[model samples]
Target: MSSVLPMDLLTYWNRYAEAPITVEESRERGFGWTQYDRHGPAEELLGQPETSLELGCGTGDMTAYLARKNVRAVGVDISPVQIEHCRQRWPQDGAEFVCSDVLTYLAGTTQKWDAIFSNWGALWFTDPRAWLEPVRDHLTDNGVLVFSCAPPVEGCYGAQGMYGNGFRGRVLPVQRWAYSPEMWEGVLRNVGFLEVYAKVLEAPEPDNLGTLIVQAWAR
Candidate 1:
């Protein structure tokens, strides 16, 4: 199946540019993979790699956070507006932002990273069957891949349609991939990843949703 059109994603994400993580908030809290801060910082899972790339880095908050920690960090997003906003928000030396489809960027770049991560980002929105292999190819030996997304809905796995609130009364179309933690681990292993781990971090409140965080080693 065809993926969500980039233009649609760009338009949908442009609506978020008005309200981004403030500089103070970014400096103080950095970034978290789980919604509602239910889990610890993402860096703990990442293990402080010397070079890292963040896929679908909205507003570049996480990228800037890593750069401050002295990691050479690059953030990639499909939205030019969000990327421009990121560039303006974090004009530091270590952080870099590129506006491109995540899969295209991964396939085109020859540079490898020590760690690659997505925080409710591209890995959720893209087809992993088409994505995981190139991601493995772009990582240094034994490099780490980490990401988080909402736990999969029962009976709904694979590319699914999601509607985003757009300008005025309009609703935009997007596609997202959802899979159970077990399914995710299997897919990663099939893509040549080793030491695969996937778990759902339950929300603090019983009524709220949980996050599925996955980590794997490139081999």
Candidate 2:
């Protein structure tokens, strides 16, 4: 299970979590993105491992996909409702889902993973360096950590700029912290990951602006 911070407050999370399935759906429909469609350098970086862990497996769609690839896949999230939904919706004998914060999870666990994957689940919440530390420590010597984050610059769908509600796109405002490809590599290096490869991979859609995908290998 993940060990989330108390400051986040269950009320704050649960307040939103109870509506995750609905809101998550609305956010997806309103934005037009999904786990099945979220493939890029994030997966390519891991390159198909025999074992995988999804940090914030939202509705567990990607977790199911990873389970298909490797029977021993697992996922973790902060929403209890979301975890319940994932368990009921994406039930696989070989897969497991836990409800906890990724930061807390990494703080407690020493289980080495062959591959750790987070699909847009770790962006903007906080400085990833502190959270990814556990990811680095729990990964096998030859393991790979795959995470998709907002690229530096003004290319996102403009959630805040569009909503204008001050929620700030719900992903946090870290673009300023991330400027170049090497900037992302530096974050990974801070957590002990070396051999970084990053690029701004614009998608085939005219509606998308954040196209860069950053990947790093820890060996």
Best-matching candidate per TM-score: 1
Count of steric clashes across candidates, in order? 0, 3
Error of 1 at 181 (Å): 0.6
The alpha-carbon RMSD values of the candidates against the true structure, listed in the order shown, are: 2.7, 6.8
> lDDT, candidate 2, residue 65?
60
TM-scores vs. true structure, each candidate: 0.91, 0.71
Residue 172 accuracy (lDDT) in model 1: 68
User: What TM-score should be assigned to candidate 1?
Assistant: 0.91
Which candidate has the top score in lDDT?
Answer: 1
Candidate 2 CA-lDDT value: 0.61
lDDT of 2 by residue, 1-219 (tens): 233345434444454445444434533432122223443433446665777778877777666666756647878888787788778766654578889878877777767778787766744344554666677777777887766655666443322222111354332222213446666777678777877776666655746755555556677
Can you tell me which runs of candidate 2 are displaced by over 4 Å?
Answer: 1-42, 154-179
